[model samples]
Target: MLIVSQALIPHQDGVTLHPDLFLWDKQLADRKQSWFHAADRTPAEWYASLQGSDVTALLARQIEVMPAATSQCWSVTPYHGQLMRDSIRVYPEGLFPWCSEDAAWLCSTLNPLLAEEGMTLLHSGAALLLSCRDALDAKPLSFAAISGKMLPNRHHEGADGGRLNRLMAEIQMMLHQQQPESRRQRGEVDVSGIWLSNPVAWPQVIIEKKIAVATRNPHLSAIVDGQNATVVISEAERLDQLVKGNVELPKRIVLTGEGYAVLLNRSLLPTFGKPSWSPKRVKSEVELISKLSGWIA
Candidate 1:
């Protein structure tokens, strides 16, 4: 199976992509394709669905399970940013740069504030985990999904909708006040606020075999079962290296992008004797990329 972890760097704005950005252009042209982006979802969310989980619950199984069943757990994503005056848009530059010492310090400063809500920050194996004493049945958007967007207001629907929004607002205020002067002298942006994802749970065991993966994404690598081959992860740029000569590529080819994905395989191929609606064959580089990215024009 070939999982193009990021098949295309897509734009939600309907901007067309250059064909050169497409990977392995000629290699998999003859193979069939079936786009899997019928609903709105990030590539991460789509992959999570394939694992029998959703964006909110995958973390419960992906991260190490703590024995405590009374608390809610989350993987922390501390972002360096400035919330724009627009009141709804966050600077896209708010990407988190993980520095062990810096992250630890930030958590220490913020832990006391989190304690007011019965939450604690834990630095575990390169992951900043958030554990809460009360059950939070709300779904927090992934940072990837909201990179170009803004955090949802408290009115966003969920069981704990109001609290979720309030918590984010509080966190933002705390970060602004607690930012250190050293980082400022370096002309670095403030570690203003955070966007959390991978809401893991307590005491539930997910058993999957170790899988072989090839990618540079740390978050993507952490969730895979390295000891088994059930889940295969690959990068869009390295599809050619993943395929070999004389042998056909794996039947499952998942072309994923920012908020969409397409499943390509022989099963979706047009059959001579059968009559069914099927997407056209990938005859050229233009068609190949356009098909994978859901772009036309």
Candidate 2:
């Protein structure tokens, strides 16, 4: 079963690092204590690094002894009984061709940790908040788990090139056109610009994505459009039916096994509240990390 865990990024001095791209920048990695290299590190060494126990210790605190009660203690699903819905932001830097080797390694490392507790890491799409909680605030805040990096194995050539570029150009255009004030009133816009640009992009497909979530609870939506880039959930009507019907939707959803991680924010939760959706911004840092532990297990 998949569970949600949320962590806050340091946004000091009005400078907040985009969570998705935070690990992509070598400069930033060099200065911080990030597990961006976990995938490449041997499990023995990786587990050794968490010895002192701060973050990992916290993770340990959240663990539980299974019914069989063997040597392996595991974490209970973090979001299992939690009430609040999460809103995640997936940065472009986490896209293919942009993620670094270490980023991929990190993902490989973390996957097993999740699996130990009976969960799998998915190459899913997510979204970010179109407007910061504080309009005057320059720092980025995430309501969901931001995918820090992309899978380095994916390729960007061939027919996919056309769709990728179109989506990219469209995102750039929307970022340029949609201002904070405008988006506030309009709420959010679809991230169709990126999908339309990808080479092998085909937006009509829906492969286990969070098409909609209830707005009454505050959530974002994810969907596949005519283009393949994965659209952001900006409207709540799609989710409205779901809410009326009552359902449990993933906080972060993907259009395909190899698709973008689109996030749904409160503004569009209403549509997701019904049952469905897909939104935007400027230059943002992106990162991608894999779960190596899963591979080992």
Clashes of each: 10, 81
lDDT of 2 by residue, 123-210 (tens): 1122111101111111111112222322112324545344333433444454344333433455433221121110111112222321
Give the Cα error of residue 195 in candidate 1, in Å: 2.0
List residue ranges in candidate 1 displaced over 4 A.
2-20, 23-31, 38-47, 53-69, 82-96, 99-103, 178-190, 198-201, 225-252, 265-297
Candidate 1 Cα deviation (angstroms), residue 205: 3.2
lDDT of 2 at 255: 16
Name model 2 segments beyond 4 Å from true.
5-155, 180-182, 185-297
Question: Residue 135 lDDT in model 1?
Answer: 69
Q: Rate the local accuracy (lDDT) of all candidates.
A: 0.53, 0.23
